[model samples]
Target: MVSVGDDAPDFTAPLADGDVGSFTLSEHLEEAPIVLAFFPAAFTGTCTTEMCTFRDQMANFEDVGATVYGISIDTPFTLNEFREQNELNFGLLSDTNREVIDAYDISMDFADLGVRNVAKRAVFVVDGSGTVTYTWVSDDPGVEPDYDEVAEAADAASE
Candidate 1:
């Protein structure tokens, strides 16, 4: 996994912003700090709870001058549906090819679940300079990151 102080891997992928645009991490990094919440899939119970938590606390993230994104291996189409269904306020990114997932070392094999190359539950805070400031990778798929700690990391990154 990419550790704290390591430069965040640059990636450009389709965004679930209900448009034909793509999101480039390096480009966004040039502007402000970023909070990346990587989930295994969209619409799952844990994923929904985690995303809604981010949505509910989006103002805090904005107050700290940070951009928030929820990423998954789901396609943009599916993510668009999930976003609309959940009323998510932030962008959901599609890492369908798992390129970014692999680069971040968050991929897991869910053979029992009949899925492969899915991302593990993880969170990463990247400063404006593109250095990873904080990371949390859950060993259990059902576990969620500490939202308070993630917000604190984002605040620290802004500073």
Candidate 2:
């Protein structure tokens, strides 16, 4: 996993931004800090709750000049539906190929559940300089990150 103070891995992926736009990590870092929330899948209970938490606290993140994005192995089409259904204001990035997932070393195999290469529940805060300022990887997929800590990291990165 990428640690704090390490340069965030750069990647561009299709974003479920209403119109199928793309998000480049480095490009976004040039503008503001970024909060990347990697989840296993869309429409799952835990994923839904975690994303909604981010949505509800978006203002706090925005106040710190940070952009929030949820990354998953799901396709953009499915993610767009999920975003609309949940009224998510942030972007849901499609890491369908699992390239970014692998790069971040957050992939999980669930052979017993018949799933593979899904992302572990994780959060990463990247500053304007593309350095990872914060990271949280949940051992259980059902667990969520600390929202307050994430917000504080974003606030600190903005300064």
Candidate 3:
């Protein structure tokens, strides 16, 4: 699993930010602190709430010049709908192949639902230099990250 102080793995994937585009981690390096919020799936109860919370707190992230993106195994098409429906302010990255999840070592299997290799609910705060400054991963998909702590970490990382 990716830990704090480790180099954040770089990957390029489809981004759903009102328009379909490509997001490369390396390209965004040195711009600002980046928040990568990985969730199992979109349009679900916990995922919706978590994403909406981030949307609500986007001003805090913006105040610190931090960029946030939500990631999931859902397709960009589905992610676009999810973003619009939830009024998410940040982009959603599509990891349809589970490459990002595997790279971050946050892959999980929802065997009860026959879903496999989905991203575990994880949050990684990466600074401008591509080093992880904070990380939160939950084995239980229902759990959400502490928004205040994440915001503080991003604020500190910006310095």
Clashes of each: 0, 0, 0
- TM-score order of candidates, top first: 3, 2, 1
lDDT of each: 0.92, 0.93, 0.94
**Pairs clashing within candidate 2:** none
- Please report the candidate that would top TM-score against the real structure: 3
**TM-score for every candidate vs. truth?**
0.97, 0.97, 0.98
Is candidate 2 or 3 superior in TM-score?
3
lDDT per residue for candidate 2 within 45-74, as digits (tens), equals 999999999999999998988899999999
Q: Give the clashing residue pairs of candidate 3, or none.
A: none
Better of 1 and 2 by TM-score: 2
TM-score of 1: 0.97
RMSDs, each prediction? 0.9, 0.8, 0.7
What is residue 135's positional error in candidate 1, in angstroms? 0.3
Compare the candidates by lDDT and give the number of the best one: 3
Q: In model 1, what lDDT does residue 74 have? A: 92
Off-target runs (Cα >4 Å) in candidate 1 are none
Task: Tell me the tens digit of each residue's lDDT in model 3 across 105-151.
Answer: 99999898888999999999999889999999999998999999999
At residue 99, candidate 1 shows an lDDT of 97
